[model samples]
Target: MNSKLVILGGGAAGVLIAMKLASQNIDVTLIDSKTFYEYTPALCSVLYEETDAKFHQHFSEISFELEPFLRKINVEFILGNAKLIKDDKVFIHQREEGIEYDYLVICTGSSYADPWKTQNGTECIDLNRRINFLNEQREKYKQAQHILCIGGGPVGVEVATEISYRAPGKKITLVDMNKTVLANAPDGIGNNAQRILNARDSITSIMEQSASQKGQEGNTYIYETDKSHTEIKADLVYNCIGVTPNSEFLQANHADWLNEKKQIIVDPGLRVTSNVFAVGDVNSVNEPKMFYTAHMQAIHFVRNMSRIIKNNTNVENLIPYHPSRPNMIVSMGPQYAIGYVSGIKLTGWPLGLNKGSHLASWGKYTIERITMNSCHLKIPVNEVLYLTSRP
Candidate 1:
């Protein structure tokens, strides 16, 4: 009998790995809490106005149903939470018996404050639930007169600027503990973002400040800044601080496999043990936790896994995974963006050409389609609407 391979998480890493392995006539089972796989990089576009219907789409449009895609690729899809992992066996939340596997890969990924980054922890498990949740948030954003965005990172900055483009008159206060926006990025990029935020209509940038939620009354949210000790109120507050890894399931018996930040620790080959491996945001690889990074890791791991299986090679013979240099594109709005790639700073028309008028929504859609195509799944009509490669 062929070895049984089980993969956890349905995000970029796991999904891509499953597709690649299944193509090689490998038997694989994928378990994930989310029923739909979302193209999370385009999540910011969900908050903004749809100036161009061809480029803009609802959050649901970018999130493809997982079962159909996985099944089409000859991979078994299990819709359940992974509760525990014992030696050679994995357990689910409601199941009493553990599922046996010859090889295991952990790609549980991370969770964000926003619902768009839904994975294992998110309450919206199905497509309908996610659609309703996103619609509710969009309604709140449309009616909000004052908005507070806590954090000056990519997510916070993108949310602030996207809302600004949609509702210019709305008063938006962006607070961050850093000296400027995009604090983790290159200094020049952050400086450029600060200038853009300052010039944007009614979007205020309050740097070197941190805010704590006081409470909420009706639709109003109250917050207090730490450094300034000032109280601010807004109709809506977005907590875009950062993401937490979905590695809590490993805490029961495998706590030693995790780091202080609760991320899984793996070797250079992305292996946790002789038969176990970890990938994507859940792993502490000292690299940027972007979807592209996750995708690259999945491709590399799949290649290594193929060698181990077909050639019956030892673990030491597997190729080591090298960390790639950081590359990121931060979209401020539909027409403008700033990026860092190959140790060079980029902005304006070059970014505009890459991201298009819809703020990289097209590029993200293309990525989703490419993944779906690789898995031998049919693209839905809603997704096909934005299929043009003009971006």
Candidate 2:
């Protein structure tokens, strides 16, 4: 029998690897709890003024049936949560048995709480439904005279600006422990965001303050700040805090390969061991925890894995990862955005229209197409609307 290659997580990295290996007639099995892959860029963009029809179309378009796609690619799909990993074996709680493997690749990425970044496929669908319901409640959002947003991260800033765009008259209070918005970003980018945010009477930016939820009462939320015992009351609240790496499965083993925060440590070529590799957000690689980075790692790992399969891969020849600056387009609204690429800061309508528009969705879509094609799976044109592409 052929040596079995078992992959955990059907995320961008895992899916790409499965597609490449399965199409080449290698014995590969993919395990993931998510029914479909998510194009997160679109998710972030939708907080603006995306119509109901547009949201539905994009959500459905970005995610394809995970099981069917993998099966079509000749990769076995296992719809179960992975529980633990021993040397050369994986224990899945649902199966109640350990499965052996000649090689293992883990790509279980990170997640956010609630409406942010959900962990599994079921949670994703539930969140989508909630978003739909949330859309219906936009009236409530607008009716709320004051809105409090906790955390000044990308998502937090995006939500603040999006709310500012949709309901210009609504009061928005964006609070972060950092002294400035996008504190980790280039100084000019953060400064620019502050200028734009400050220019609006409806928006207020609070720095060096952390808030704790004081519970909700009659659709009203109360937050207490650390400094000055400030009490900020608002009608609606969004929590965009941090990325929690999905490495609970590794905790049981006291996995020395993981940091105290549970992020897996990977070698230069993105390997945990000679026969085991770790890619994407789950790994503590130098790269940012973004989908595109995972996709790129997938390509690099598979090329080396292909050589390994053919007994021509030299360990020394394996590609080492070099982290780069994250190029991002952060839209304050549908028509305006702020961005930075290679130390060059750009802000305007054109960047928003191109990189932050539905056109940007097409770029992610193309990557998904290439991934699915690698797996020998033909995503029907109907499955791919103008804005969604998936593996």
Candidate 3:
């Protein structure tokens, strides 16, 4: 029996699944708050425009209209806030009727920072508008004697490196409560990142101290760290810390499926319920919530879904979900980046080999390969199922 599949996110996972399933002529619907998708990997590069003329040129490439993309793949795109999830149905605000589905895939991602950067990477035009302001702020920051970045996470480190490349001679300070940069990653990752970043003469990093408070007074910005009443002053501040899950809607109804962190918990096959499954950051998978990992889970889920849709009797042959290997590509500047793949560091020649570069040639390639979005995917069931289940 064919089924109406509804996916409740427009992130890497949701979009890839929907596009793949839709290409197979499956009835699919994708719901998101925005009409477009923002390619987040390219977001940091948007600020490092090669020429003044091409300031907004890359914005188009980084973010694009989802409606047309979905249309091309034969999936329906609905723009609205998903406010609730009930028995086999999703409730959307500003819509008179609810959408019901035979199978539901929840991929709603997580986000961090003020003004809340949705992990889904939607609200395209709106984000471009904000980036414009950041461009202006970048100009202002270029003139400031000192700048304070209050996180050593990806965003903070990326922006700091970008500034070091774009606007040298200005001081950039990064503060994080962790012992090192990218603390969640492997020890080598954080240590190597710290070594590269601190190598810059103008950059300063403060670790193991939590930012207690931040406020602006007149022309100066103030940040107080938790220990020793440490006060740091700067002309501007960027808070690039913390992530809040976008799983509140599920809590109101499917509370039992959520963990203590409010993240959706799922079985080995990523199933939340009999006909409900989850992928990406919204789910409590024991792995880093990254675009690559999400897309991997999407492929896994879609392949198994194809099997289930084909024959339910071979349930044991359904491939199990596993956490992707711990890998990271942190762009340091336009020409350099810190990347680790399967515990092996990627560096040297071929400018696009690693994560850094305005071209993002390699990142884009990996994304395209991982997505397989528009491909008509079919699974060969009863296969070896040799994939292991750990990072």
Best by lDDT: 1
Q: C-alpha displacement of 387 in model 2, angstroms?
A: 26
Best by TM-score: 1
Reference-based lDDT, residue 157, model 1: 79
TM-score leaderboard ranking: 1, 3, 2
Per-residue lDDT over 177-224 for candidate 3, one digit per residue giving the tens place of the 0 to 100 score: 888888876536666677767778878888898775578787788888
> What is candidate 1's lDDT per residue for 116-183, written digit by digit as tens?
57646523288777777777777777788999999899888788887787678899999999888987
Stretch of 10 with least lDDT, candidate 2? 382-391
- What local lDDT does model 2 show for residue 18? 82
lDDT of each: 0.77, 0.69, 0.71
Backbone clashes for every candidate come to 0, 0, 0
> RMSD, each candidate, Å?
5.3, 5.8, 4.7
Locate the minimum summed-lDDT window of 10 residues in model 3. Answer: 377-386
TM-score: model 2 vs. ground truth: 0.81
Q: What TM-score would you give candidate 1 relative to the actual structure? A: 0.87
lDDT of 1: 0.77
Model 1 residue 333 lDDT?
A: 76
How far off is residue 132 in model 2, in Å? 7.6
lDDT of 2 by residue, 109-135 (tens): 887754555554323233355456546
Model 1: which residue pairs collide? none
